[model samples]
Target: MTEAAAQRAGRDAEAAPSLLYLVKRTEQAVRARLDEVLKPAGVTALQYTALTVLERHDGLTAAQLARDSFVTAQSMADMVRTLEARGHVVRSPNPVNRRELLIALTELGHRLLDDYRRPVRELEHRMTGGLSAPEVDQLRAALDSAWRQLN
Candidate 1:
């Protein structure tokens, strides 16, 4: 084969989708889309995820937030520090365990989350616009299973 033909053949072979490739690509696209939409509001996707978790389950320790947010403890600490500095989160001594610090969303944090709700929902709608509700559920289940298998 000519060099051009050889390169085309290689590209064709790599284009055959695998679950891993598809998942990674989807994650990248989703993150990019979220970042673009959230930039004006001043939060990255990871920061938004941390905020969302805290909103749902308040008063979690830094370590717990790290696990829930799928981030390293060090990164979570940094994120928490940044959020606290921005007045979006507050850290207090865990009453039950004085050694650990429990983090909670401040009123500002709640306000920020509330502000993003509509945009985030619209983004989700756009993402799943092609899929039926059942398919969306199945996709969620399959992804959850895959995550459980790996972790």
Candidate 2:
């Protein structure tokens, strides 16, 4: 290949946005669409995700759930309060740790989650439309590696 052609190729590559920028933009688009789809259910995606985590790890503290779900403690606290008001979550004295309160999904919480679970799964797939299974796996691996490298 001629030197001029090689230089032109390098310039074209440099002119394109980095993969990280595209990934971040795509993530934002997914979040925006999810939030829109979740609006009618009267629950944000974050709230629903936290509830899912609580379902998986029943009787978890707000702190524990926050850490597991990658959310802030204050955000979890707010969600718990909202869920409690909606009759979806029950906060009780921690049996093992009296000093801190533990949160659990009430029977109502489980039912409500069940109702929304189908739509949630559908929305997730829709948001990730056009991505193949292997492509999704590659994205996951890349993100996990990036997170570990950064933190």
Candidate 3:
């Protein structure tokens, strides 16, 4: 190839965003959508994620919830307090670790999740609407693999 053609090709490649950039962009878009969808429920996307994590693992420390919910420990502490104040979650002394309190979802939290289930599902469907079932499966696998590799 001519040197000028090769230089143009290199510039074009450099102009394209990296895979990681695309992945993070997608995450941002999803979070924005979640914020809109959950706004009526009076919950932010991060809070909803924490509640879901607690739903899956009933009792976890603020630090654990923070890690799972992709927030800082301080942020999780604040969130726990907010959720508790809202009667969506409760904190009790951990039987295994008396000094630490475990956060758990309350009945109200579960109901909140149930109420938003359909909307959340619809959001997910919209995300993958362009892909075939097999392609969706592959996308999930690929994303999971990437996560596992980094994690």
Tell me the spans in candidate 3 whose CA falls farther than 4 Å from its real position.
1-3
- Model 1: residue 93 alpha-carbon error in angstroms: 0.2
Candidate structures ordered by TM-score, highest first: 3, 1, 2
Count steric clashes of candidate 3. Answer: 0
TM-score of each: 0.86, 0.81, 0.95
Please list the residue runs of candidate 2 whose C-alpha ends up more than 4 Å from where it truly belongs after superposition: 133-151
**Candidate 3 CA-lDDT value:** 0.96
Q: Tens digits of per-residue lDDT for model 3 on 62-114?
A: 99999999999999999999999999999999998899999999999999999
Residue-level lDDT tens digits of model 2 in 1-151: 8999999999999999998899899878877776777787788778878888988999999999899877899988988899899988998998777999999999988987898888878976786678998987887798899889978
lDDT for each residue of candidate 1 in 32-123, tens digit (9 for 90 to 100): 99899889978899999999999999999999999999899999999999999989899999888899999999999999999999999999
Global CA lDDT computed for model 1: 0.93
Model 3 alpha-carbon miss at residue 112, Å: 0.4
Q: How well does model 2 score by local distance difference test?
A: 0.86
| Per-model lDDT | 0.93, 0.86, 0.96
RMSD of each: 4.4, 2.4, 1.2
Superposed Cα deviation of residue 51, candidate 3 (Å) = 0.6
